[model samples]
Target: MQSSSSLFPVALISAERRGDLSEDVYRLKPGNSPDGTVELAVTRLGLAEVAESRGVPVILLHGSFSNRRFWYSPKGLGLGAYLARQGFDVWIPEMRGHGLSRRNRDYAKNRVADYARYDLPAIAAFVREQSGQIPHWIGHSLGGTTLAAALGGQYLGAPAVASVALFGCQVSRTYWPLKIPPVEWGGRFILKRFAQLSGARLKRGPEDEPIGLALESMRWHGLFGRFGDGERDWWKGLAEVDVPLLAVSAAGDRQDPDWACRKLLEQVGSEHRQYLCLGRRQGFSGDFGHVEMLVSKAAQVEVWPLVERWLKDPLTPVTGAQPEVLAVG
Candidate 1:
C-alpha cells in the first residue's frame, strides 16, 4: 500500500498497532545517493495516543550484521520502542543490504565510506525535513563508528544533528599483526574470494557483512593507516565536533573495551561530552556485554533511564544520573 507524505518520497509499507504504540514501516528510496542504488526501510515508532508532532525525532543506527531489529524488536520492545512510548519520534534506518534494505548490484562492495559520505546525510535530511527539527542520533557498535565517520568527515553536522550517542563503538583498537603489510594484504587477498562474511559461521551475529567491510577494516588498521578514507582524517576531525556527545562502553565487551571506547570519546572536540563505563565496578548491576549493554533487562532497569535523562537535557549534570558509588572514586 502507498501513503502520502509531505516529508520525503517513501512508500508506506505497514501501519500496525504494537499495543499502545503505532508502528509505521516505510520503504524510502533516496536516489540522491551517489549511485542511486540503495533502498532503505525506515521504521517509525510513536505513541498511539499522542500527536506525532509533539514527539521529537531520534534516529537509531544499528551495528553491522544487524537491522532495525537491533534498536526495535517485533514484539514492540527495545530502546526505539521505549523512546517512542516516552514521546520520541524514533526512526531506525536499515543500511544498504542490511535488514529490510534490499541489496544492490554492488551490495558486496558497500563500505563505511559510502555510508558516512552519502547514506547518513540523506537519512538526516529526510528526517529533518519531515520533523521540522534536528534529530538526535544513537548508534551502537559499527553503527556508532559510521556516525563518528560522518561527523568527522563533515557529512552530518549541527544543522541536522541535535546530539549523538555512541554505544560500545570504537575504531582505535590496535591489532599489531594487521599493522604488517604482508599480514594485512594476505588477509584481504583471501577474503576477496568471498562476497560476505557469515555472521552465523563466525557466531558473531545474525547478519552477514560484505567482504568490502573486512577489507576496509584491514586498511584502517594497516601501518600508518587512520580512521578516515584516503581523503580525510576522521580521527583528527573528531577534534572539530562540538555537539553534545556521549560514549558508552561495557567492561564485559572484549571486542570493544571501555578503554578503547573512552579514547574515541576523548578525541571529540565537544565541550559537552561524557564517557560512561558500564560495569559492576562502575556501580552498575553487572558488567554488561556488547549487546547486553542495551538489550538486557538490567539495562532497562538502570541504563535506559540514564539515556532518557540525557536526551531530555544534554547539559544536565550526569553525576546526578549515575550511581552514587562513582562519586567516591
Candidate 2:
C-alpha cells in the first residue's frame, strides 16, 4: 500500500541494493475476541536480495502512537532497512489500534492485550510456519514490554523464542511513580469515549495522530516518570521468561531508568543475558532520548551493531549461571 504522506528516501550505498527492499501490508487472523473477530494489519519490509544470503529473520515492533512508518525516516533511521542490509528478513507490524490495522473502526476497542495475546504470537507463528525457523525478536518501549510479556508465558509457550532483545523496559517497583496525571486519567477516558462513538475505528492520518493519545499511553504505563504505575504486572511476568535475553538502556531516558533496566536483567532466571547502557561518554551512537535510540542516525553506528552481534551468537546457555536479581547504579 502506498503511503499518501511525504516519502523521505532512506540512505543507502547503492541503488540496486535499495531496490531489493519492498514494503507491503498483511492481514492476520487473530482468532476471536468478544468484541469481534480480530484482524491485525502489518507492514512488512522484505529484503529479497540480502535475506537469502544472510539466512536469518528479524522482526521489529514499534511503540504506541507511532506506526511502522516511524522505522523508515529520511535520516536512514529505519531499523528494517538497516537490518535488511545486514541480510535479514525484517518485518515491522502495525499494532491493533494503529495504522491500517485500525479496521475495527472503533479505537476504544483497542487493548494492550491484543499485542501480548495476539500480535506477537501471530508474528512469531507466521515466521516459524513460513520460514521453518524461529526468528530473533526485538522490541522497543511498549513493543518491548509486549514481547517481554509474551515471552514470560502470557501468550505463546516458552522455548518458541530463540533469542529476545529489549530496549527501554522498566521492570522495577520503584520506577512506578512517573505517570503524568491528566494523561493517565484523561487519555483513557477520551479513547474509551472515542471508541464508543467511533466504534473502535479511526481513519489513517495525513497528519500524525494526536500527541495527547501518545502522552496518555505513556503516562498510563508510567513511562514518563510521573506516577510510575503500569497497566499490567509486567515485572512479575518478566521473571518467568527463560531465554537468551539482552536488555539495553539509555543513560538519558527518563521513561526507563538505567537502574530499572539493570534490575530487570538481574532478576531474570536465564543465565544467558547481557546488559548495556549507552551515552555520549560511553562513545556510543547518539545522545538520544527514549524514542531516538531506535530512530536516530547514530543508532546504525552504535545500537544496531551490538544487537547484530548478540543475534549472531549461538543460542547456548551462558557458561556461568546466575540467579535473577535486580541491580541499579
Candidate 3:
C-alpha cells in the first residue's frame, strides 16, 4: 500500500486495472522544499498488457477548483486515459490542498508562485526519477499559468523537460479595474473575508479554491503588478525560455481569450513553438469554452491526436483537415 523512493519520498497508494490499462496512485512528499512539507497525489496510467513497457511520461495538470479528475475520470476516461492508450505513461498531479492532496499548513496561503517554484518542480523531478526519462508537461488554465511561471522562473530547467504544452493558459490579460487603488483595496478586503471560494456555489467546479488564489490574482492584476514575486520577473524571464512549446486557446474561451494565449506563446523564447486556436474557423466542430476545450467528446476525436503528435515530436507539423494547428517555429 506504501513505498518510498531513494531520494524523493514517494508512497504508493493503490494500483488497479481498467480494462487493459494499469492505473497507479502515489503521493510525493516534498520535504526539501522551503515551503514546508506537503504531500501531492500523482496518478500514473499505462498499458497493462505490455511487460516492462511503461511508456514515456507526460504530466497533465489540472486547472483551478479541480484535481487529477480533470485529466482522468473514475470510468477510466479523459485525456490521461487516451494518452495511456497511445503508448504514453500519463501522469496527473493534484495541486496542494486539492483532491487526494490534503490541505497543507499553508493551504489557504498558497499562491501560484508557490506552486510554480516548488510543487511543479517536485512533481517533475519525481516523474523523471521514476520514468528514467525527461517528461513532457501539459497544463490547463491555472495549471498552464503555473507551468508558464515555472518555466519563466527557471525552476524547471530545459534539461529536465522534453517539451511543454499549455491549454487555455495566459498571464497577459489586463483587468483595468484592478489598477485602481480603491478597487484594489476593496477587492483585497472582500477576498480576505473568505478563506476559500466555493466552487459549486460559483458553478466553476466541485472543489473549493483557497482564497489565496483570488488574492494572488488580485495582486497580479493590480496596479504596476507583474507576473513574478519579489525575487524574479517571470514576464521578462520568459524571453529566455527555450523549450519546445505549444500553446492552445479556444475561440469561445473568454476567461483566457485566444489573443492573450497567442501573446503568451509569443513571449516564450522557444525556437520550436506553436500556437493553436480551436474553433470552427480552425476546423474544430464549434467554439470551445474554457472547460469544453479539453473535456468534450469532440476534443477526443480532433485534439488528442495533435497532443500525441506534439509529445512524440514537437516539431512535426500537424497534417489533418479536422484540426488546423498553426505552427510557429
| Model 3, span 1-329: residue lDDT tens | 34567766688988888887898889888886565658899988998897268888899999998988888888988999899999998999999888999888877888898888888988888888889999999999999999999999999868778999999999989999999989999989988988899899999998989898899888889997899888999989998999999999999999999999999999999998888998999888899989988898988888888889888888777557677778886
Question: Which number leads on lDDT?
Answer: 3
For candidate 2, report its TM-score: 0.72
* Candidate 2 stretches greater than 4 Å from native: 1-18, 50-54, 74-77, 171-234, 314-329
User: How do the residues 1-329 of candidate 2 rate in per-residue lDDT, one tens digit apiece?
Assistant: 43222221111212223365755556665554454545566555557554444457777777655667666643334777777667666667777656656555434444455567656776677666555677888888767766766765457445357777788876453423435566456555655443232212443322233333444344435644422224445446656667778777887888788888777677666657777676765555445677767767677666666666667783532211212222221
Task: Give the TM-scores of the predictions, in the order they appear.
Answer: 0.95, 0.72, 0.97
User: Residue by residue across 1-329, what tens digits does model 1's lDDT show?
Assistant: 44345545678788988888888777887776666777888888898877456578999999987888888888888999899988898999998888878887787888999899988987898788767889999999999999999999988889989999999999989999998899988998899999999888998778899888888988999998889998999999999998899889998999999889988988999888887888888888889999999999999888888888778886664554445322100
Which candidate has the highest TM-score of all?
Answer: 3
State each model's CA lDDT, in order: 0.86, 0.60, 0.88
Error of 3 at 31 (Å): 1.2
Give per-candidate clash totals.
0, 23, 0
